[model samples]
Target: MGQLQLEEELGKGNYGTVKRVLHKPTNVYMAMKEIRLELDEAKLNGIIMELDILHRAAAPEIVDFYGAFFIESCVYYCMEHMDAGSMDKLEAEGVPEDVLGRIAGAMVRGLKFLKDEMQIIHRDVKPTNVLVNTKGQVKLCDFGVSGQLEKSLAKTNIGCQSYMAPERIKGESTGNLGTYTVSSDVWSLGLAMIEMGLGHYPYPPETYANVFAQLTAIVHGDAPELPEERFSESARDFVSRCLHKLPGSRATYAQLLSHPYLVEDRNRDVDMVGWVKRALESRAEKQVQQQRERNQQVLEQQQQGYQP
Candidate 1:
C-alpha cells in the first residue's frame, strides 16, 4: 500500500470503487480495487473469494493481478490498468462484426478458463465487466459476485437480473430454487453479445408495463436472436446456440470455441486497436457534450432566480 500512489477513480459499484493507481517503485500504472471491510460473514467471504480468484487466475484473457494489502478498514488489490476501459463505455453505434467476433472469442476463452481451470462460475457476464485496452486485448474483471462450482452447480442467484437465463428466472418466480449451471453464464454471454452488436440490451424493460412483466417475458417468451440483416449467418447461429430456451440445450464453452464463427474469427485479422481508439474518442466527446448541457441548465436556473 505504501508504494502505490492513488489517482482518479475509474468506477464505482455495490462492492467498492476502482481507481487508477501507480506503483512508485516500478512506475507502472495499475487499477486498484478498494473494498471496505464489513462485519458480515457473507461479505467477508465474498471479498476473500475474489482475492483468491484474482491471485490464481493467470491467463492472457484475464486481467493480471499484482498484489494486495489491508489498509485500516479497506482491502486494496492492484490489477493491470486497461487504458480503453470497459466495453459498455463505447458509443452506441454498435461494434463492427470482425471486432465483435474477436471480443466474443476472448470472453469465451476467459470464462472457459475460469470454469475449467479454477472450477468457478463468473455469475456476472456483461459488457461492463469486460475490459479492453489500447493493445486490443479483452479481459474479464470484477469477480465479487463469482462463486465456486459445487458439483457443477452454484446454488446462489447472485447476479444481474436482466442477464439471468430463463431457467434461473423461472426458478425465482416459482420459489422452486434450482442449481445454477455454467449454461446460465452462457446465456448471459449471448445477451451481452447482442447488446454489443445492436448497441442496447436485447430485452428492454421500457417495452413492458412493469418489472414483473419483463421478467415474465424472459421466463416464457422466445429467446432473442441477432438481426439477420446486420449480422452474419455464422454469428447468428453461434448466438442462437447460446440463447437456447433450455439450459441443457445451450452450447458448452468447448462447443462454442469450436463453432465456425469463432473458428473463422481466429484466422481473421480485426482492427480492434482502431475501434478502441474511436470508442474512447466518442466517449470523451459525449462527456464534453453532457458537461455543456449541465452548464446551460445551471445558467437557465440562475436567470430564473434573478427574474424575480
Candidate 2:
C-alpha cells in the first residue's frame, strides 16, 4: 500500500489503536489497527497470530484483511471499514429480532469455518467483536485471543469474565482453568445474543459488589436465558440451546445454523439496512444528549465556584 491519509481515531483495543484511514491511490477507506511491539514482548506473538488468522480467514462472514506493515517498533494493518461499526456501538435500546438473527447466523458461520477448517477457537466471542456494515452484512472480527484446539479443548483462561461459561469460571476459582471446548464459544454466543438483544450486559457486573460473588453466580446460578414471553419460542429455544451449563449439551455451530429462529429469519424479507440505520441514528442522538448534559454540569459547577 502507498501513503495513507489518516482520519479520526476509531478506538483502542487490547492489541492496538484502530484508526480510520484512506488509501491514497485506491481512494479506499480502511480501518488501520496499529500495534506497538515495543510495549510488550508477548505482543509480537499476539500480532503474528492475529495476522495469520486474518490473512487466512477470507470468508465474507469474517472481516476482510488488506495488508500489514511492520516498522521498527510497531505494526500497522489495514482491514475493511465497517460503516455500521460494531454491534456494541448500536443503540442500547436493544436490537430487533430479525437483526439479531442475521448477526447470529453470520457469526456462527464464521466460527464454524474457524473451527472446522482451522481447528481454531475464538476464545473471546463478545458483542464488541462482531461487526456490521451498511450493506446488512455482519461479520466477526478481532482474533487476538483465538487459539488452535488441543485435544479438542483450549486451555487458556483468556476472554471476558461475564461471557465465560460456568465450567470456565468454576475452574478458574479452583487451581485449574477449565479446558475450553467449542461449546464454551457457544455459551459466549448465548451471552452475546442476550447482550445485544437487551442492549446491555445480561449479567451487569456493577450489580454485584464482590468479585467472588459474581464468579459464584456464574458458576452456580442458572445460566442466562431470553425472556420467554417477550420473544418467539424459536428465539427463546435457540438461546436456551446455546446457554446449557454443561458444554456437551450446548448446540454445536452446525446445530445453531439449523435453528428455527435463524431459518425463519433467513427465509423472510428482512429490512436490515433500515434497522441498522435507525439504531445508529438513535445512538448519535443519545450521544449528543449525553454531551449536552456533561456541558450543563460543567457550567453549573463554574457558577457555584463564583465568589459573591
Maximum-lDDT candidate: 1
Error of 1 at 196 (Å): 0.7
Residue pairs with colliding backbones in model 1 are none
Clash count for each candidate, listed in order shown: 0, 0
Candidate 1 TM-score to native: 0.90
- Relative to the unseen true structure, what is the C-alpha lDDT of residue 184 in candidate 1, on a scale of 0 to 100? 91
lDDT for residue 54 in candidate 1, whole number 0-100: 81
The residue ranges of model 1 lying beyond 4 angstroms of the native Cα positions read 40-46, 144-161, 173-178
Clash pairs for candidate 2: none
Cα lDDT of model 2 by residue, 11-90, tens digit: 88744699999999889999998866554557566667768867888887889989898878878889999988998898
| TM per candidate | 0.90, 0.90
Model 1, 199-253: lDDT tens digits are: 8877787788777787778878888888899999999999999999889999999
lDDT of 1 at 125: 87
- Candidate lDDT (C-alpha), each: 0.83, 0.80
